[model samples]
Target: MTRLPKPKALLNKQWLVGLLFVPFMAMALPADRQQPIQIDSDTADIDNKKGVSVYRGDVVMTQGTTRITGDVITIYTRDRELTRVIAQGNKARAYYEELQPGEQGIVQAWGNTIRYDVDSDQIELIKNAQLSQKGDTFTGEKIDYNLTLQTVNAKGTPSQGDNGRVQMVIQPRQEKAASTK
Candidate 1:
């Protein structure tokens, strides 16, 4: 005859104590990792507890094709991965651009600077700064780049007459269509 083990012994069993596996857990992982183009700064202070990277003094930060240069650049991280980067420019301008893997271009911007936090997953464009992409340009008091959603937002007074404050012009790769003419 065999005797059943006590509750304490059964609870302590190694096999029973193994990690639980759930198929649904895979959905929790992120799809794309964060990769910046360039990070330039005179100083960089990292805080693991807060999961933030702060760069000061002539800081220029870029990710992939995006380029950001400012007096201060901050990078935010969550789960040991970088989530967002914000560049705070001086009287000078900061830059950011979205491009295909091999595409490259210059993104001109200027303002009080930029601040991005990982927890919020936002790229904040602030101050009297401006943002531009290709031929499109916008000048706003503040903007947010939502990484998760892959979208950009703007909020501020626009440039007069020219709509300098809020401008969006997507360049058409319409050469194929034009060739038919």
Candidate 2:
């Protein structure tokens, strides 16, 4: 009879031991909202602290309207709530949740290799990043937005923050224009 190697025998080397922990490391990472996510990548790194989560790699994560594809995705936690999120990559996109008018409240989204600081509730998008909501949109080299203040500040690039900023309102487009264009 043939027998597979014992579990202990497989993990004698330090490198092997470290390698063995990779899955547990990935599994131990805390993310209440990312379980149904699917990623396509060669490798990954996950860090979680005080409810905030960070994912790094050639990452492609998809969950319903939220799709974050980037080299890194950092999720911020506030009071144990998912207050802010950031994704950084070659390019990132998120179908940020929105609330219809008269429906009480709506959730907003920030997309493209982005960074979100939960304590400050700030969202930053980098490198070909774009933020859009309904018909409102902003595209630049990098974008910094404050969710609490309901304001947006964008720079042409990370280095040049003084060039100027654009302000906008997000709304649903007209039925005619949306279909044709």
Candidate 3:
């Protein structure tokens, strides 16, 4: 009689409030937050009286676990909230997956331009900005993140003469050795 298996349930905060959460205060999305904002585009343009919405070819967006791809994506809302969201592309990318209480994984970014600011949750990556988590990485031409103060601000643009300079790759933290039964 040996059967022990039941440990798979983490990722919360409503999928980090649709990814990384602007300011990530438990992953934003208030105002009764309803979720559901899937978008796929080959071409799209909506301007409900200038609320603004434009998606160009090869764009992809999700609203729950935060997934973003791009060729172009621009969304800006006002009274309805959602301040801004712009994603351009050559490599604009984004992803999300979070778990606290002991930490989990997944959080990525890449850019040719990727800005997402809901009031001020902030998430701006420009030029060749790159960001990662868990495995640690941070390259830059510009990268600003503050999803709930996880904090990060990188920049590099001396005309990119030497390819600028703002690169990081920290990944050395593994301490778990205390089990004696």
Q: lDDT per residue, candidate 2, 52-126, as tens digits?
A: 566666665554434556677666555555666666654435323323334223334455556656467566776
Question: What local distance difference test score does each model get?
Answer: 0.54, 0.49, 0.66
The TM-score of candidate 3 is: 0.31
lDDT of 3 at 153: 69
Q: Which number leads on lDDT? A: 3
The residue-by-residue lDDT of candidate 1 on 49-168, one tens digit each, is: 998888888876655545567777778777877767766666566554444222223444456766655566555777665655455454557665554554556555634433333434
lDDT of 2: 0.49
Model 3 misplaced stretches (Cα beyond 4 Å):
1-48, 52-102, 105-114, 117-124, 127-135, 142-168
Q: Model 3 over residues 57-123: C-alpha lDDT tens digits?
A: 8888777656677888898988766688888886434433223322434567887888888678788
Between candidates 1 and 3, the lDDT winner: 3
Better-scoring candidate (TM-score), 2 or 3: 2
Candidate 1, TM-score vs. the true structure?
0.55
TM-scores, each model vs. reference:
0.55, 0.45, 0.31
Q: How much is the lDDT of residue 14 in candidate 2? A: 28
Q: Which ranges in model 2 have alpha carbons more than 4 Å from their true place?
A: 1-42, 46-67, 74-86, 91-112, 157-181
Clashing pairs in 3: 22-121, 23-121, 23-148
Residue 11 error for model 2, in Å? Answer: 62
